[model samples]
Target: MNFDYTLAFAKELDQADPLASLRKDFLFPKQNGEQFIYLCGNSLGLQPKAAREVLEQQMANWENLAVEGWFEGEDPWMFYHKELKSLMAPIVGASPLEVCPMNTLTVNLHLLMVSFYKPQPGRFKIIMEAGAFPSDQYAIESQVRFHGYDPKEAIIEVSPRAGEYTLHTEDIIAQIAEHGAEIALVLFGGVNYFTGQWFDMEAITKAGHAAGALVGFDLAHAAGNVPLKLHDWDIDFACWCSYKYQNAGPGGISGIFVHEKHFTDTSLNRFAGWWGYQEAQRFKMEKGFVPEAGADGWQVSCTQVMPMALYHASLKIFEKAGFMETLRIKSETLTAYLIFAVNQVNKELGFEQFKVITPTEAADRGAQVSIIAKDKGKEIFQQLVAHQVLGDWREPNVIRLSPVPLYNSFEDVFKTAELMLKISKEILI
Candidate 1:
């Protein structure tokens, strides 16, 4: 896996990519009729070319069938999410029955917390990585408060060692061990949004259980970006959004996973709705809540037909691309090449202009490489944007560039680095 920071080398890789054809499936943003090199899939994915048509078909069903669309349309709005759950399960590694497409990411997190984040007596603390996506932090803080505990005292944050950018697995394991007796739940992002660190889920889950705690993850970045084994890892629960790597439309439908072990646990609590009522007797208007057999039981309200339609369209493309394992192969090499090319720019400048804080090891990261651009991070980012090289910038310094395997080419990676090198020479501090 040698890398050369050359346009010809990148084009050669593009020519050999088995997933190269997928680039045609998405419609990229344009600048003066030319396509932009979109590396912002970590923030928002490019739209699929057929997205409009997919929406229209669902729209047509509603137009033609009216209320009957619930049970009469080709996909039957009643159960449209079923096929999507099946397609998504293997991407994150779970049983189809354990996965369900429903509600927004944070909402699902709350719903799941209601059932899994039980705290009592002295064993009431929650352990999580520091600087998690803010929504997760809020969820944990709010949940801890709802149970009448002080957030500062009940929430234990496992921070990186001083001056380090990422958490080591050993440090994470040690923290769990040190607080095992008091931790009620161990929750984390499957991949940290800012640093792009993919945590060791299996070890975390085992450590949590050994300490008599439940475990779960918010897979907002990791779900479609890497190959996961949520069920195999014995994680108690998990959730993810479809917009990023799943390429569902903006604020796309979210999904959740509840392990089979929790399905019949009568003591667990849930915020239930009629949609969660067992399908066979749902319309009977029964009083007592009887949940559908699996993760679908967590649904809080009637499905939003359109977002699920948008997500289903993207899921179909995932099927054509031969799933996440195939995508992971390209993801690893694509990101490694991004790292090499970015470093090569620094090499030519005779200084390290940008420092990649994301883990360089393939297993520790997914598609993203987070970089801190010395003092010009934001300036470098704006220049990259002006040149139609679209990536993401954080508040002060970091830029996140993700070469999505489904659409981004090796040429995209090279040209971005070439532009970065060019911008460095042209821009004055």
Candidate 2:
């Protein structure tokens, strides 16, 4: 598909889009009394218009039902999180029993580590990509230290080859094999938050399992951006925050997936709470902690009703949009167009003024395409923001832009490119 960066072409494609109508689902942010061309879904997704009603309904439950809201209202607080399981299962390609919504991403990561990342005598190392999200880095380091080992010896970081920005699959597999003997766990982000590189989970899982290690993923950026098959891939455990791609508001509910293969593994330990006690005997407040049948056994607290309501609103929109594969189709074309338009700006300058560091291969990346300006990346980012192009900038020299398929239209991408090219001439070039 040859993409044209002309104004007419952008508008024509948008006019013909089947998913165009879906943009109405979100409430785009306005600046100077006009809507900004928002391209920061990678950081935080736009709010679903239906969110207000969901919140209001929850408020009504509080006002009308009072203490009885726990079990009597339209959506009872006692079992509200249960309602979201089947709705969100398809987003990560897991069965209802294997998935549950709970604590934040890093919290769930800590809980899962308690069960999966048991470093023993011979196998006491962990392998991960070098520049993971800072929180993940901290979590792994703390976990390793808590086990009474130095991080320098216990955490093995797999870096890219010289001058490369992304990891090649072969190198990742080789790294796993090289350290296979001493590694106990292989934890990775489903998509790198900075580079937007989507790892091959199935291959990674196979390699980790063959290496006699358990595998898991932090899907903060990948959950709604790409199709995943946690169960089919045989992942041991996984967790994701809903605020980014799932569009559940800031610091929204997080989800976890634990394989049914671990359902009866009594050897595994959990930081037990009454919420994790067997449902039928939970009210008895018994002395012993009997776990629930599946992934819900990992849940340790009462559900946060409002946050789950916000998440449910977005899940309904996801169901309305059909499968995640459908969204990926539009995301690929839109992000590819962004790459082309960014390149065209450089081509017009008769040099590579901006280099896109994100992988060009569709399978290797999701919605974001990270751009590095030759001389003025920060200035270029500021200019885009001033023009109401809502993209975020990273440290050093990278500008990250994501033309989300949900709320961003082709014309938004076109206008962004036009403004960027114009700004390059007026300021950058």
TM-score of each: 0.99, 0.99
Q: Which stretches of candidate 1 lie over 4 Å from their true place?
A: none
Clashing residue pairs for model 2: none
Worst ten in a row by lDDT for model 2: 420-429
Per-residue CA lDDT of model 2 for 1-429, tens digit only, reads: 898979999999899887899899999888888889999999999899999999999999999998899889667898888889998899999999999999899999999999999999889999998899999999999999999989999999989899989998889899999999999999999999888899998999999999999999999999988999999999999999999888999999999999999999999989988788788788888798999889989989988889999999999988888869888899898988898898888888778878999999988999898988778878888988988899999998888888888778889988998888888888854
Angstrom error at residue 230, model 1: 0.7
For this target, which candidate reaches the highest lDDT against the unseen true structure? 1
Per-residue lDDT over 196-310 for candidate 1, one digit per residue giving the tens place of the 0 to 100 score:
9999989999999999999999999998899999999999999999999998889999999999999999899999999999989999998999999999999989988899988
Judged by whole-model lDDT over C-alpha atoms, candidate 2 comes out at 0.91
Model 2 lDDT, residue 328, Cα: 87
Clashes per candidate (backbone, < 3 Å): 0, 0
Model 1 clash pairs are: none
